[model samples]
Target: MARKLPSRTTSDDTKSARTRERILDSTAAVLSRKGYSETRLTDVAEEAELQSPAIYYYFKSREELIEEVMWAGIAHMREHVEGVLAALPPETSAMDRILAAAEAHLRFSLSVSSYTTAAIRNSGQMPERIRERHEAERAKYGRVWRKLFKDAADDGELRDGVDLLTVRMLVIGSLNWAAEWWTPRTSKIDNVVEQARQLISNGIAK
Candidate 1:
C-alpha cells in the first residue's frame, strides 16, 4: 500500500507556507495514485481544500507544480541516503555503506513519502522543460550513488572493469521499481529491503 504524507507545519511557519505545503503534498499524492496525465489543478484543489484559482497563486501551472514536487522528492532522498552514510563510523567498509544506503533507499521508496514515489512514477513523461529540470535533480541524486559505487571501487569491493554509472543505474533502477508493485499486504518493507540489500551485495560481486 502507499504511504500517507506526514504534516510539515512548523510553529513559526506562516499559514501561507503551510497551505503551499498542503498543495504540494496533495499534488504528490495525486501524481503517485493517479498518473500525471490524469492529474489536474482541480483535483489538487479538491485534495488541498482550496479553490482552483488558489493554486495559481502558489504555482504558475500544473507542470511547474509537479516539477517542484519532483525536485523536492529527489532532494529528500539524496539527503536521507547521505545522512545515513555520514552517520556511520569512519571505518565502516564501503560495501557496508552501500548496504546501508540500499536499506534507506528501499524504505524511502516503499514507506516514506508519496513525493518520491510520484517522482519515480512520472519520470521521463513530463513536459520538455520539466523533464530537463527534473533530470538535473536526478543527476544530483545519481551523484550520491555514484560516490557510493566509486568508494566501493576504491576499496576493491566493487567488481573490476564495471562502469560506475552502469552500476549506479542498475542499483537505483532496481530499487526505484519497488514503488511500482509494492503492497503492504504482500511483504513488509523490511523484508523487501533485506532482499534488496542481499541482491546488491551479491550483484556487486557479479
Candidate 2:
C-alpha cells in the first residue's frame, strides 16, 4: 500500500486553526486586563502580533471574538472538571467525587488562565445574543455538576431537605467567587480547596 500524506489544503487548514487559537488567546488576555467594554480588536491584534485587520479574517466582529473567547473559557472549565471526575478511582465515594470536582474548579479558577477569569468577570456584560450563546455553553457545564450532585444524593451522601439543584448553584457560586478574591500570595489553592471541601462535606454529608 502507498503511504498516505497530508494534502496542501490540510496544512493550510492547520495553520488557519493555529491562527484562530492565537487570536482567541490574545483576546482572553486583553479581556482579563482591560475587561470586555475596554478591550478592542486592536489590542487583541497587538497581543497576537498580527495586524488589526487580520482578526476579522477569523472573527467577523468584536462581539463574535468575545463570544468565541467566552465559549472557549467555559468549555475549558468543563473539560477540566470532567477530567478530574474521570480520573477518580472506581471505588471512590460520592463525597470524594464531589470534593475532587470542587478542588478542580477552584484550582482552574485560581490559575493564570485568563480565559476563565474573563468569562467569570465579563460574561454578564456580553450583548444579549452573545450572552445567550455563552449561557448555552455554561449550561452544559451546569449539567455536569447536576449529575454529580444527583448521584451523591441518590447514594444518600447529601443531607435530607437539601435540593441537588440548589447545592449545584451554591457550590459553583462559591467556586466562581474565588476568582475574585483568591491570590497565591495571600492564600494557597490547596488550603482553600480543603476548606471548601470541609465546609461542603459538613453541610451535605449524612
TM-score of each: 0.90, 0.90
Query: Which parts of model 1 are misplaced by more than 4 Å?
Result: 1-13
| Model 1, position 98: C-alpha lDDT score | 88
lDDT of 2 by residue, 1-206 (tens): 99988699999999999999999999998998888899999899999999999988888999999998898888899999999999999999988898999988888878857889889978778878788878999999999888888889889888899987777898889989888787789788788988999989998889
Clashes of 2: 0
How many collisions between residues are there in candidate 1? 2
Which ranges in model 2 have alpha carbons more than 4 Å from their true place? 1-8
Please tell me which predicted candidate would have the highest lDDT against the true structure: 2
Error of 1 at 114 (Å): 0.7
Candidate 2 TM-score over all chains jointly: 0.90
The lDDT for every candidate, in the order shown, is 0.87, 0.88
